[model samples]
Target: MNGAGTKRRIGIGIVGCGGIAQSHAAALKRLEQAGECTVVGCADLVEEKAKGLAEKFELPSWYADARRLIDRPDVEAITVCTNPPFHVPATLMAAERGKHTIVEKPMTMDLAEADRAIEATRKANVRFGVIFMRRFWPGAQRARKAIDDGKLGDRLILGDCILKWTRRQAYYRDPWRGTWAGENGAALVNQAVHALDMFLWLMAPAGQLETVYGKWANLTHPYIEAEDNAVAALRWANGALGVLSVSISTDPQLGARITVTGDKGATVSVTEHPEGRFGLNDVWTIPGEEEEMGRLYERELQEGREHFKPFPIAHFWQLQDFLAAIREGRDPLVTGEEGRRSIELIEAIRLSTESGAEVKLPLRTSTWVPPTRR
Candidate 1:
């Protein structure tokens, strides 16, 4: 029990031993070192992979099958770090066994799976959360605060999410990297979803999502089936018109940036460079309000520097939030439902591309159309 007055250490397990699992293992190690939790178990389809990560993280046990890890008596909670295809199954196994579950992003391949995961966790009476760590960034937090507090004025006039991350052809060499079925959609669904999630967060997900138009191109990497770039124009629920441009095609990979403009002629923007790591390179605030907001941003930086490792500090922050929510017996900061909204939005964008027409929200088409050559 990590509740306010309790000191019980939560025993946690890592379900997949892939590349991203390393980050989760490192985070759990940090928590273990702080006396907050322990990494008791690890699992992967490849026995060697599981064994290697367990040895690396100093975890006590490893399993070739996820069920073995889930069925373990000591694992009170589990983080589903499996590939996108396995997210739901892994999480369902954990929740049904009465273990709190944390799922990685894109929650599931689509909204239906996401809803099922949410319902199953609810029925099992276990806490459920999704990893969208970018939401925990300091500049993002301040921007959200300003919007909620009306510092950005009553209406958002414009918003743009520009994510230009680079990946060589070698990056997609894995079977899952650029495949339609294995990795789901291309740039919009894979790389840009995080930025899109941020856009939806700063805006809000409910209400009518209108005028969604998108086009995807395979510009580079002819060996792969998925598009390297995509552009979408849409109207957010709040009636804020915006454009989201994402690509892994850029040569140098520009920073992931989000700029929101309000009716009051004020704009709040945050640009984070891939090389610069987690801290924002530019947290542009309205001129007169900088003294007040800059202090707030500085405080976030100070706390982050004090409590976190240099790289991927946001993951640790979000993981702490999940633990605290479990302890308090409350919903996590980013619930499964909240995480699904971004997938829903992206799916709508894809559906628009497929039909070559503007699609409506609560997308009627459940079909997934992978980005392929024309």
Candidate 2:
């Protein structure tokens, strides 16, 4: 209903049947039920994963190789859920086959690959979207609205974000995760990326970042070649300063949070998952306009929860936006170019850590891969 019409359902497929694939599968099923699309097939390097996902989502076919799925005439679009390195390659494959693509976050290993992927989609004339689902969250939407309405005044002064989620050593046992080459980076790029994106979105109008410096360490999980914790401080061109901290070593998983302060004495904060409660906004406050903003956020959060239960509502909304973008011949909510911001920020953090000096705005080089040292 959000797109052209229920009668002209878009054909869809998925590649990479990993943990995140479940979310994509469920979202597709919901959209299919709404008659906006059809789940035509799926593919994975592991044949069993593909078969299992196909059966779980009731897809018509499964393939051991993604090329097969891309080649399928019935699959007009695809969701790429592979590792960081495979993102660009798989996306380009789908683009070459004239398929709209929705990629899971981090876009790719580095900016060079991101540029290539964006160019591929542009040349192919297909819709390209990144799954920064937090953008669709009710609290985030309200926060953005408040900022846009001048509630936060002209300039932001401070923004602090922390992602203290826990992942067991066993979780990184997967060969492709928690590795510099495989995941591109650890906490900052992998898990904390959501919070980073949220911070960037909320701190907008604060344009280009002036400097970034950070340090990362493998306090736990020494077997992995990536840091389990990292901290970065940033300065915006608009004179705003922000600090971002991410760690997978939080004992009880504190969840993600961002607190922003503006020069006009207005502040807004969003808590993603307080104490492991899914879809719950633990903190949302605006000094003078607390009552009105609080009530509005509460209402929207409740509505979103009621509309999308069991599965993440944000994912459903993002999928709908993707389909609608394709039908309307427009860019989706999080286009490839827009998605590059978070990656660019992450790379700045990496550069600062490696050089032990503050990295400047409009990063000079795109060649830095995720650090390989543990």
Best by lDDT: 2
RMSD of each: 2.9, 2.6
The lDDT values for all models are 0.78, 0.82
TM-score of each: 0.91, 0.92
Predicted candidate 1 versus true structure: per-residue lDDT over 262-299, tens digit per residue? 77878887666652345452555565876776676666
The ten-residue window of minimal lDDT in model 1 covers 275-284
Model 2, 28-85: lDDT tens digits are 8999999889998889999999999999989899999999888988888998888777
Q: Which residue pairs in model 2 clash with each other?
A: none
Q: Where is model 1 more than 4 Å wrong at Cα?
A: 1-6, 205-208, 279-283, 291-311, 371-374
Q: What is the number of residue pairs that collide in model 2?
A: 0
